[model samples]
Target: MKKVLFGLLLAGLMSTTQAAVAQSGSGPAVSYTETVLAAEIGKEILFRRALDWTENHFSYGPKTGAKSDAAAGTVRVTGTGKVTPVATNGKELTRVIRFDFVFRATDKGYDYSVGSFRVIPDPQKPEETMMLSDYIAQLATEKGNGKTFNDRRVTAQANALASEAAMSFRSFMNTMPAAEENTVGIPATE
Candidate 1:
């Protein structure tokens, strides 16, 4: 019975999970990448709020490939989308990365996790995406063989990508509207 229960739990977690890779201290580390916020609102209200926010911001609607579930005082959403990087010279890089995002919400707040990040080489070309993990591993391989300028460039790009995504998520949550109170914003007698 214990094994069965554990299996079920593991399955549930796996059902809604994805990536975060560690970058050189300058950026958000993917190691155990999970964010949890606290709010003084009801679970259902918070869940609905989160659903509305993501649906509005994310490119696709819930019915259009985004997975969402609300139950047991928790809400979970998973979706795939692309993030664009901006260059220092006020130019935006055309190369976009496809990423998997997992969001979990509760009465207090919510948690967002991004992983399975891959670069989509060309929009007009066939999908030839490379996983950020694989790219990082290749950098390690190159470092072992003595680092070159290209290796350093790749490392910097990966780190910047991680930083960009992290900031975007943080900003989104930070800017979310404050929980609204019902009935003239006054405390009701029990």
Candidate 2:
């Protein structure tokens, strides 16, 4: 009887954990409908993710410095970014992050960076996760209060990662040998 009661209690507790935080997924891979050289002019990244939102949404579109669906080249990028507080100095914090963007050929490749791609915010937690490894320390405990949510340290760290990802892609687009285009493919598809 004691075992049965404990089992029921465990089940009840697990449900609340699901309710308190956002879920992470393997995410979508970047795919393109048109070849880079054959893309149109204004087409953009047109894809979504598997996360839910309730409030304080940070929806982004195109490369307008803010958020818009209008894109310059043919590729449309759409993905989710999570921010977790690693270290906080008042309102400022560092963040660890992981985001996957699906890239579809729109018209043509543009000068914009992946950072220019849309960032879908997780309203439930605000802070999101990119790679599973970042939260290894948090996962050990079965019960997490989502202490990582909107963690500025995590956010800053993740943003920095995104910036670095953009630079690597920039280098690939401009510097990769033309003959390797087929072998290497789109710069941001990874």
Candidate 2 versus truth, CA RMSD in Å, comes to: 16.0
What is candidate 2's lDDT per residue for 1-190, written digit by digit as tens?
Answer: 9999999999999987876543532123222222244232223322111011101222432112223333322233344444444322335333323344323434454333343222223335634433333243333332432453333233344556566555544444445344434544556754
- Which structure among the candidates has the greatest TM-score? 1
- Model 1 alpha-carbon drift over 4 Å, by segment: 1-32, 37-39, 59-64, 72-94, 121-125, 139-155, 175-179, 182-184, 187-190
Q: Which stretches in model 2 have alpha-carbon errors above 4 Å? A: 1-72, 80-82, 86-109, 115-151, 180-190
| Backbone collisions counted per model | 4, 30
- lDDT of every predicted structure (CA atoms): 0.53, 0.37
The total number of steric clashes, by the backbone 3 Å criterion, in model 1 comes to 4
- Candidate 2's TM-score reads 0.28
Give me the candidate number with maximum lDDT.
Answer: 1
Worst-scoring 10-residue span by lDDT in model 1: 18-27
Q: State TM-scores per candidate.
A: 0.52, 0.28
Tens-digit lDDT track of model 1 for 100-122: 55667765666666555565656
